[model samples]
Target: MIDTAIPHKPNPTFEGLKRNKVWLASITILILLAILSPAQARFSLAFTLDALLHTAPFLILSIAIAAWAGATGADSLIARVFTGSPLLMIGLAALAGGLSPFCSCGVIPLIAALLSMGVPLSAVMAFWLASPIMDPSMFVLTTGVLGTEFAIAKTLAAIGLGVMGGLVIYLLARGGALADPLRAGIGNGGCGASNLRTPQPVVWKFWTAPERRAKFGREAVKTTLFLAKWLVLAFLLESLMLTFVPAEVIANTLGGTGIGPIALATVVGVPAYLNGYAALPLIGGMLEQGMAPGAGLAFLVAGGVTSLPAAIAVWALVRPKVFTLYIALSLSGAFLCGLLFQTWMGS
Candidate 1:
């Protein structure tokens, strides 16, 4: 007898595991290491766990801050800086981008909204350049993984890069080089646009309301999980790199105290970059292997701005000319920042 019963679908748990690329990659690496080199697998696991434990305090603080901001709607304040004079807006936007918690992809919707609302391209460019480099959570994590001084330098670099980009776009915009920056058929960011256009009042004491409490819980869980997976993967990679990659090799390639190494690092950064959080431990490993501080900085800055995801989003959203300008600014700004940082370190 032909039954009309529907076929059972694949297990949800299996499907979820399949979709978690980072975790899958991590597990695969560990399994391969175990099979090929049990000693290295043991060492890598221990290293990853130890690093995670050491970073616990900073991780908790970062998670709380991110979740609190989300629950309280503090992100709305970001829109306020877009008003005022173009120069002032540019400055403020750059500063805000350094401080704001938006990632590269996360900033795209906001960019679309600002561009659609007649906000000057200079200020938008400023925010766009800086938004991916540093944020409160990222700064905290950076301080934990890299040193406080390095984190501070990175934060400053983010703002400086933003300002540089803003100024360049401003001058070119004045010369009529960049008009109608958005690509055709792009809507005003849909859901995210309205939030910027009419921001809701922030509720500082979000715990008072049931919905806000729920939101806080959700945000906290989400942020914690996100950071955990990336950091675990990062520390694991660091362990492998430290064990396998020779110091002399790193030293000879990216270790020299000169602009040449920094430039090479800037170029390498665009493609070699993994994820921003994931890159920290890898950079730490590189530093230990004699990679220069300036090269590290260049890699971080360039990777943050021109990572595949970030660059793709920019290309998809803007006209070709604007996209070209963004790439030019990112590479130049990264090189300049690295050079300045190297000089400062030498001094």
Candidate 2:
């Protein structure tokens, strides 16, 4: 059995503060580290903040959506609806996941609840693959950074990837491959959520409840710290990459329109691409440096789906086989996107 307890204890560094306070201290370290480096800490801070400003609206909306859904017992109800037609459910789940504003962390609790409620694996896989890639806010940001065409292509690609993962998961289920879908602790609140089961009926006044407000505050802080840490690191790395990596080098190395570039792109993308928002300016920089259009798409698709944070969230909730399937689907979809784009767009 996987012991998924989140540790909570006091230390000298933290004194009497809680876990959230520890997170805040860690974020402060990141800022201080930024100032000491050749990364041009001030500029990186500015860049990261600008990106966060743009992302704040989407982040808030995603949280609100999840909060309301949880408060109203809508998550499991929606899951039950997907049990009838797996194929159609897959499609709709993919679209809805792509459009949903939640990040991987924001959606983790919902996933745990769905699994506990016996949601079909097919729909769950679709939602998992699509949830972290693109949302309405992500779409607008991508369009501004890359272009309208790139943005549309990315949106379509996210849905397509979700569908593909859904089908594979469905087949795996039919074959009796996995003995279980939810991991040892997932259904029992190992996903760090206590109220996964059906709770007391919450109405429009859910927001007015004192306990509900406290829960929301905790979630909000946790999410902000999670996002802020990764984004700060991502922006710092992006700054370093921009400063050291030259345009000519990027063009000559990754500019080729072939299998090699596509493979290389997806592989690097799995690790290099951090946050969807931070990836935009970095990718835009690459494009300006004559990076191949297809490669750019491949990079974005690959990284967005398989980013470390997103992958970690999945790993925590799922068994190894399903986790492997998620990565496989992401890489394959990225390669396919690269091929199609290069063939048609000639980039």
Candidate 3:
């Protein structure tokens, strides 16, 4: 369980700068570019700014939706879907996971809470599988960067992966394969456990209350800052990639409409994925450089679920068997999604 508390320290500004590593990295990259090639640095700055400006509308809308959900307490309602029959719960959980506002890391505490409350691991697995792949914000950002078709395909993939994982886990549980899914001391408590355990009624008109309005503002600002840093870095990296990486190289590696490219992409995604939001511009750049659509989808789906932070959280929370199952399901589902999408694109 992640502690939400912030410990007081001297030199708070320095501490904040230390924590903002992404921004620091972005700055460092810019400084190096300026020193090594001022012309390239100017081009990168222009590219990043242009991309950010083009994406501003989507970014604002995404921020509003996420902030609204947080302030109105609608996120807490996700737990309600896990109470039905196993099949129904799994379906609803998958759908909910796709639509929910939670990020990969953000969903961990909720998953821990659900498991602690005796919600079926199958349902939780469904949500867990899907939550990292697509959220409302991610969908909007993806559409802005990749197109509506790609975003919709990714969302469907997320739900499909969830349902597939849920069914597999459900079948395994029936055979008494996964009797205890959680780690020894995990699931007992988590940062957001209380909210899931006893959900509060949502206030749809969040602005009607002062506190809710304040909450909305805070959430909006927090989400904006979070997204801004990643996206700025992403656009910078994308500009550099477009300038430095040869199109033929990308095409040769990830461009072919074959299982090999897609499988390779899935494997590479596990370790190479930066951040869900950060990856969009890079993927967009790859596509422009002739990367196959299927390979792109496979990479995004695999990385979204099994990124380092997300993978670590799952590993720390669940038993080795469950963790292994999660990785297996993620890889297989990503490959299958890629294959089907490739076939569809060809047709």
Candidate 4:
């Protein structure tokens, strides 16, 4: 049985959010100003609202999943899944990450929990780096938009890159090259419930408890606000690019194949790729405009790894060194995947 007699602790994440509310509010106000700007008057309020509404379900699902995972005996289950072998754990964790329904952001709570429970950071890195690249729904959407080959390649890349990341971290940990893989300070951040003082005694039957619901509600509010703040900024930037940037220019810049375009695709993909779901049609449009299939793959993989919201959630969870290593491995794997897929497409 889990302990119910727990004391209140300062939720660093929530407190940090509260402190940063001013910045968030400032960004919101700026977005409104941009919308109301006479030069930008034609900018659609509907577009901004649609983006927000579109992401609502994902955000909600992230929070609920976090809450449920927190309340369950998932820690033991997660640990049990990995035997003593580091390689096996890395392979399985990466595979689990790709197969799991959770997104990069939604799994934050669970990752935090796992790390807190002494789960190998290397194993978690494998899962973390891979989980966002593709999921079942994302897979179906990619196949429909990009074709079966691309989708399958992406799924494979997610797993492969995850393993690579896990192994790199594993070696790093073994050599004592890095310290504190799980960055200290941020507690229970992301879609996961904050201030999880205890695992709530009921474990599996969590829905029956008032405390669980309350915890869920608290996390929901914070996650929504945190995501919304970054999203508004991202959307506003996207809108400006759509309005002012020319498709022809983009096509010319990223439309080619080979190493140059592939490298650009990987680098630009970090900012270019929006949330995974919305990126499909946008990518399809780019492909129609002569964007190389390999470049597109690079963009998708890199973007998923480096997207603002997901990246922020990760930065909050881990130290700067680990985060930097993650970005390097992700982009490296993304480029390699793009190279392989590019050759396949040309063939």
The best-first sequence of candidates by lDDT reads: 3, 1, 2, 4
Local distance difference test scores for all models: 0.92, 0.73, 0.92, 0.72
Q: Is candidate 1 or candidate 2 better by TM-score?
A: 1
- Total clashes for model 4: 0
What TM-score does model 4 achieve against the real structure? Answer: 0.64
Residues 257-335, model 4: lDDT tens digits: 6788889999988987767765665666577667888888888988987889888877887888888998899899999
Candidate 3 lDDT tens digits, 197-314: 7789989988999999999999999999999999999999999999999999999999989899999999999999999999999999999999999999999999999999999999
Write down the RMSD of all candidates, one decimal each: 1.6, 7.4, 5.5, 9.7
Candidate 2 residue spans exceeding 4 A from truth: 1-83, 189-236
Highest TM-score against the true fold, candidate: 1
Q: Distance (Å) between predicted and true CA of 143, model 2?
A: 2.3
User: Which consecutive 10 residues in model 3 have the weakest lDDT in total?
Assistant: 187-196
- Top of the candidates by lDDT: 3
